[model samples]
Target: MGLRPQLMDSTRSQDQDQNSTQDATALIQQLEQDRAWLLEQIDRGRWQEFRLDLAALERELGQLLQRASEHFSSGSE
Candidate 1:
């Protein structure tokens, strides 16, 4: 009985981790797409308009990547 509950809890934890990883991946992909779109607009002479937005997006992406790296590394341990 005790072992069964422990196994269930472990399974739940793994499910949560998988969901979190998927969410993070989706977010990163979206951010990359947004960055590419912004760059395309800039190339078409919209630099001034999207410049600040691009910078912010880059910072957010960097932070997200850093957090993900840390999270996964720690999980591996």
Candidate 2:
């Protein structure tokens, strides 16, 4: 017999879970890289530029954390 409906649904759900976890991880990594880049700019004594970059990074980090929280909460439900 062919695969049951429940099995197919479960497989698709697992695929979605994996993809979302990967996306969240990638976003986290990107934010970390942005932070490192900002630190490097600061080390170069670009205070003004660093300030702008830091502000932008802070906003981006907030958004990422919100997304991660939503993802985890939804996954748990």
Candidate 3:
């Protein structure tokens, strides 16, 4: 009986990990897109606001990666 619950818990954990991985992958794709946009903005000599937005997006991506790293590292235990 206890084993059944343990097994279920393990499965749930695996699912959560998979979900996190997917989220990370998606975020990376978004980051790439943002980077391309930033490059284009730079080439076109866009306004300062676009530059600021790019900076903010880069910081956000860094934070997200750090968060995911912490979650993955802790989850292993």
What C-alpha root-mean-square deviation, in Å, does candidate 1 show against the real structure? 3.2
lDDT of 3 by residue, 1-77 (tens): 86999999999999988898778767766766776676677567777667777667766776776676677566656
TM-score of each: 0.66, 0.58, 0.61
In the order shown, the candidates' Cα RMSDs to the true structure are 3.2, 3.7, 3.9
What is the clash tally of candidate 3?
0
Q: Report the candidate with higher TM-score, 1 versus 3.
A: 1
- Give one digit per residue, the lDDT tens place, for model 1 in 8-51: 99999999988887787677567667767766775677767677
Q: Which 10 consecutive positions of candidate 2 have the poorest summed lDDT?
A: 41-50
Runs in model 2 with CA error above 4 Å? 1-3, 49-77
* lDDT of each residue in 13-68, candidate 2, tens digit only: 99998888778777767876776776677567777746777767766776776677
Q: In terms of lDDT, which candidate is stronger, 1 or 3?
A: 1
Candidate 2: TM-score? Answer: 0.58
> What TM-score does candidate 3 get on C-alpha atoms?
0.61
Q: Which ten residues in a row have the lowest lDDT in candidate 3?
A: 68-77
Which pairs in model 1 have colliding backbones? none
State each candidate's clash count: 0, 0, 0
lDDT of 2 at 11: 97
